[model samples]
Target: AGDIKAGRAKATQCAACHGIDGMSKLPEAPNLAGQTEEYLVKALNDFRTGERKNEMMTMMAKTLTDADVANLAAYYHSLGKQ
Candidate 1:
């Protein structure tokens, strides 16, 4: 389990596409709110590892540490019901 408070703090950079509330403002970005933590973690990991490739996401995901991925997944999942 991740710390929600820490996750919230770490999510500022994600707010550009995925809203602060975990809703995506851009059509290309998926809404992250209410998504399963496992899904979010896997998606981010895929982006990080090149298993899934979106140009922007791949770049962004590459910079994230393992803890960052976990925290991000936690924050997004906390936004609403799954």
Candidate 2:
């Protein structure tokens, strides 16, 4: 849960597009809330590594450490997909 809390704090930056809880306010941004941890982690990694190609995501993912990806995934996953 510590990671989740940390993630929530880091996620304030994300709240501009994905809500503080992981829901997205922008139509172009997918909801991060309730997504599976694996998916979130993979997506972040891909963006960071350039396997996925979204201009904004590429920039954002590069700013994340592995820990950030894990924590964010944990936090978003805990929010549940419903």
Candidate 3:
């Protein structure tokens, strides 16, 4: 498991859309608190590569490095659903 502290810092930007607890209040946004790491990584990659077509997600994913993805995935996985 990665450091939660580190993950929190990286997750700051994510909170705007995802919420602090990983639950998105928006209808279209999916709750990510308890998602699998593999799924999170795939989604991030999809956004980054344009395989998925959400403008905001694509822009957000572009800001993340591989380590950022791993750390965020670990953090979200730790939440175990909300």
Candidate 3 structure quality by residue, lDDT tens digits, 1-82: 4555677789888887788688896878888898888898889888988999897888899988888888888887778843
lDDT of 2 by residue, 1-82 (tens): 2298888888887899999878789899999888888998999999999999998889988889989999898889989944
Report the alpha-carbon TM-score of model 2 versus the true structure.
0.92
lDDT of residue 61 for candidate 1: 93
Report the candidate with higher lDDT, 2 versus 3.
Answer: 2
Model 2 clashing residue pairs (backbone): 34-80, 34-81
Clashes (backbone N, CA, C under 3 Å), per candidate, total 0, 2, 0
Most TM-score-accurate candidate: 1
Query: Which RMSD does model 3 reach against the true structure?
Result: 1.8
What's the TM-score of each model vs. the native? 0.93, 0.92, 0.88
lDDT of residue 9 for candidate 2: 82
What lDDT score goes with residue 7 in model 2?
89
Clashes of 3: 0
For model 1, residues 16-35, the per-residue Cα lDDT tens digits are 99998998899999999979
